[model samples]
Target: MQITVNAQPHEITSNTLDAALIELGFASPAVATAVNGAFVARGKRAETPLAEGDRLEVLAPMQGG
Candidate 1:
């Protein structure tokens, strides 16, 4: 399926958010995810379904002074 990740186009075979994150090499537990402008909790990633043209935003925490 084709979806947009962080405003970039990508082709992935994952059906769930969790799978997609793993497929994209974003396996860190500290990362945050949002699908189509809605936040998806860590515990719910496994049940959150993804579709073509969907927008996935992945953000990793950054520490700064």
Candidate 2:
């Protein structure tokens, strides 16, 4: 399926958010996810379904001084 991650187009084979994260090598606790402008809880990633043209955002925590 084709989806946009952090404003970049990517072709992924996973059907769920969790699966996609793992497939994309983003299986990290510091990462945050949002689908189609809505935030998805970490626990819900496994159940969150993704579709074509969906906008998925993967954000990592930023540390500042």
Candidate 3:
């Protein structure tokens, strides 16, 4: 399926958010995720379904403040 990841077009095989994160090379549990402008919790990522054309935002914590 085709979806937008971090404002960029990406193709993934997983149907759920968690799996898609792995497929997109974001396996770390520290990252935050939001789908279509809505925040998805870590526990809910496995149940959150993703569809084509959905906007996915992945944010990793930054250091050095």
- Among these predictions, the greatest lDDT belongs to 1
Off by over 4 Å in 3: none
Point out where model 1 deviates above 4 Å.
none
Which of candidates 1 and 2 reaches a greater lDDT? Answer: 1
Global Cα lDDT for candidate 3: 0.97
Report how far off residue 61 is in candidate 2 (Å).
Answer: 0.5
lDDT of 3 by residue, 1-65 (tens): 99999999998999999999999999899999999999999999999999999999999999996
Better of 2 and 3 by TM-score: 3
- Could you tell me the TM-score of candidate 2? 0.94
lDDT, candidate 1, 1-65, per-residue tens:
99999999999999999999999999899999999999999999999999999999999999998
* Collision pairs in model 1: none
| Candidate 3 minimal-lDDT segment of 10 residues | 6-15
Rank order (by TM-score, best first): 1, 3, 2
